[model samples]
Target: MLKPSTLNNKLRVLLIEDDTIEVMKLKRAIAKLEMPHEIVEAKNGEEALDILRNRDSLPDLILLDLNMPRINGLEFLKILKNDEVMRFLPVVILTTSSNRKDMLECYKEGVAGYILKPLKYDDYVEKISTTLNYWSSNELIKG
Candidate 1:
């Protein structure tokens, strides 16, 4: 079991994914890890932006999907990077897209990490666990 405090001062996550099935699976994986986290969900990048802009408490990390309705991931990343208040927040591109151009673009825009969504449930769980562990171990979570 991974202890959230061991990785950083605080643990919170904002996930922007449009797929309901994927969201359910992700929630199950998070539950299995028993890691302390305040998970916030958004159906698309537009909703995510609204939340980030209005919410008083910002998340330590954001897991974003590239393909979404109403403001895609790349557009959201651009807006976030430009904002003085939001630019510092770490963002990880979590999506199914394996396009080289997309990868390069995201890196250029300052994404902390990029992860391809796995097809299998177990594989997906492992990926999520590893990502969480890596961030925690690296102390990437904001205070």
Candidate 2:
């Protein structure tokens, strides 16, 4: 069992995004949040899955993009949901897709949250910060 304070301090975040520009924007937004987080970047779902499998400590949360080359977000979510160890970790769909079907499917597949990426830089910062703050303060799991 992981301690609450330890989990708070080492809140690992995995962002699976392919767009270089979006990645840069998100990185800056995350930096401005001023939280003690270890951010890991994955260009696509395959790489993210590889890291999740190989790493000893899995990320506390995953910010997943819906579309990408190789394995897409839905496919990756299916695989992760089926895995007993990984299923417990919260997966948030942070993508540009505003498709209703995609959003519905993501929820059906057990995504913890679905956030459409804000087009503006300032909004992006605020949204990310609020989301992270909420998750950090909440008692997600009990030891």
Q: Estimate each model's TM-score.
A: 0.89, 0.89
Error of 2 at 100 (Å): 0.4
Instruction: Give one digit per residue, the lDDT tens place, for model 1 in 48-71.
Output: 988898758788889999999889
- Mind sharing the TM-score for model 2? 0.89
Candidate 1 vs. truth: CA RMSD?
Answer: 2.2
**Number of backbone collisions per candidate:** 0, 0
lDDT of each prediction vs. the true structure? Answer: 0.85, 0.83
Candidate 1 segments whose C-alpha is farther than 4 A from its true place: 1-10, 140-143
> Which regions of candidate 2 fall more than 4 Å away from where they truly are?
1-10, 141-143
What is candidate 2's CA lDDT for residue 90? 92
